[model samples]
Target chain A: MDNEMNYRKSLNKSTNKKVIRIGSQNYVVNAERFKEFKKNVIAITVSVALAIATFGYVKDNIKFHHEKVDISLEVYDQMVDKGYKPVPADGEWDYRYELLDGIDPFDLSIYMGSEDALSILQYRGYESWDDYAQQEGYKNQRDWYNAQKKKVINPETKSKGGK
Target chain B: MKPLAVGEMLTLGDEVEYVVMSRLNHNNKDYILFANIDNPEDIVVRIEKFENNELCLMGLENSDEFDSVLKLFGDQINNSL
Candidate 1:
């Protein structure tokens, strides 16, 4: 019995596999189970990461929140009713923009429609921007617009350096 | 003062959003106005009520009415100033 025990102990040491002895029984730890568990953990982690990334991409591209969707829907319907056909989503269409946090004023030109702009001002019965500015109690259109913006663009610098 | 007292944000034909200035009640008829916030420009539209009582904005082609509205605004300005 001692000889057999010594032989098994030597075999276990040579194989580099863990072996557990309980009373008169020997139980070998299964390396395959541990390898399977590690593989599953890695696979689950990768899948979760992929799912999160895909969700973000879809949300940014085609998904709008319910409120935006509803407002846009009504706007689109009214536009269609006014004989304005919905063109394919094009670059000319400035439908989406980031919300202003009130720190940086939005550039009105970005949202200005030249046609609407001219007509609206025309309604004021002014032949030109300068005329409108003076009649409407402003120094100029630029001044009035700046007043509306409540913030000035790049201020002019006094000439501190001159040859 | 804004050219249009009451305003709503609207997207025009080019898919740009703007605020329609005001709906003025003149002689029991409504006139809708659009103004560029950044510029002192405006579009004046007379209100047209459809068979279903749905109101739509139409260009103010009537020169007489246009003059009247302009005068009204001038009066308001004078009063405010």
Candidate 2:
């Protein structure tokens, strides 16, 4: 029993030493170096506090105004009801109709026929599809329309019909 | 008021878990409650809170109504905890 008690005491002492070592690593400071440590801590705390204050101020003020822009399902539906169309999922516009309009064909198709699309186009300063096409440097629509037709009609069918 | 560490601020895309704290009033009679989410720093969110000792938490992504967010958060927390 006495030997067992001694072993337990040694174990406790080792455990205590390990805890002390860990605690010292986290919180212990030398008395002689206290002034320098205190100054460093104060500087770090002040800088961190200032940064936080500035962040809070900016977030509460300027950022809130921009972040609060309302984008709701109702608003999206309303835009659609107003004759705007949604952009295609693949982000490409179908420009086949533009080729028939006698406008230049190389103009990237705008996702037209939706309020959202119109709003986006208008926001980008496009008044009409023609204006957008002209800006993109497409020549007149006849060549574009012919090319589109050829793409739509199979070449084999055309050859068979000709023969 | 030390600036929160980079890990403290909730970013646009982050998965977090939180605990409901208490309700607080913002402006006028409008009250908002907050929860301490599992962020590096305690994220005091306004969209969720506790009522009558019942926990409530909310989701910002799928919910537009504050109440819905609170309900969802509460339910999720309850189920998980």
Candidate 3:
């Protein structure tokens, strides 16, 4: 056919060039440049692809290097035997009557483990927060603080600060 | 140069085939989301342009542009979901 002959002629004319295919169309390009471009494209694409894939995999499976260990109950029991009490749950103390007695609420330092907090915990038949946290198997006071913050302190249905 | 449409496919020099999933314009530039035909989950975004009368798919020039394009695609995908 005349069309087949023309196609053959065109292909024979560009013997030094490479055909770059995009979808269904083809473009004749410099053979050496096309090879270099393909190499660069493959390298960059493989790297980016690996990065994107590893991101999803890492997001789901990889944990922070400094992971907090679960509290060891055995260590906790030993501390309890040494006369340390566990940190009290909400509503364990009644500060309402104390407030009425003219003791400053600020002096209680309720959440803060200040000297006032130490005194209050001691008065309530429990050891100081530092001792309790150590007894509770926390690595350090900071670890205890962070762990306690994440815990649901008080439910709204259960009133606190009252007898 | 022929602009690739969604659902169209192209084969690279390595013989790996990719299918265009979506196309959009952001910051006055055009981009297309394409994935390995064999592995649909393996997706990559490229800047769509024409050079010397040939369609070219190029990597984003900067991370800022990459992030913006990523956000645009993320928002669109999230909305669909």
- Specify the highest-DockQ model's number: 3
**TM-score for candidate 2, residues paired by index:** 0.24
- DockQ, candidate no. 2: 0.04
Residue B1 local lDDT, model 1: 14
What tens-digit string does per-residue lDDT give for candidate 2 at B1-81?
221121121221223322223233333222222222222122233322344443222232221233233344334333433
> For candidate 2 chain B, which ten residues in a row score worst on lDDT?
B3-12
Clashes of 2: 9
* Superposed model 2: Cα runs more than 4 Å off: A1-37, A57-69, A72-75, A87-90, A93-163, B1-81
Of candidate 3 chain A, the 10-residue stretch with the lowest lDDT total is A61-70
* Docking verdict class for candidate 1: incorrect
Clashing pairs in 1: A120-B41, A120-B42, A120-B43, A121-B41, A121-B42
Which candidate should be chosen as best, given lDDT against the real structure? 3
Per residue, candidate 3 scores C-alpha lDDT tens digits across A1-163 of 3333432332232121333335443232346544544555544344334434443333222222112111234333433454544344473533322222322222233233355455655555457666655665666445555454333221223321122
Real contacts recovered, all predictions: 0.00, 0.00, 0.02
lDDT of 2 by residue, A1-163 (tens): 3333432332232122211111112222345334443444434333333332333333333323332232233334443554434334576543222222322122122113334344344446678544544454434234333333343332332311110
Tell me the deviation in Å of residue A83 in model 3: 33
How far in Å is the alpha carbon of A86 misplaced in model 2? Answer: 3.2
Error of 1 at A54 (Å): 56
Chain A TM-score across all models, in listed order: 0.26, 0.28, 0.25
User: Model 3: how far is B63 from its true place, Å?
Assistant: 4.5
Q: Rate the local accuracy (lDDT) of all candidates.
A: 0.38, 0.32, 0.47
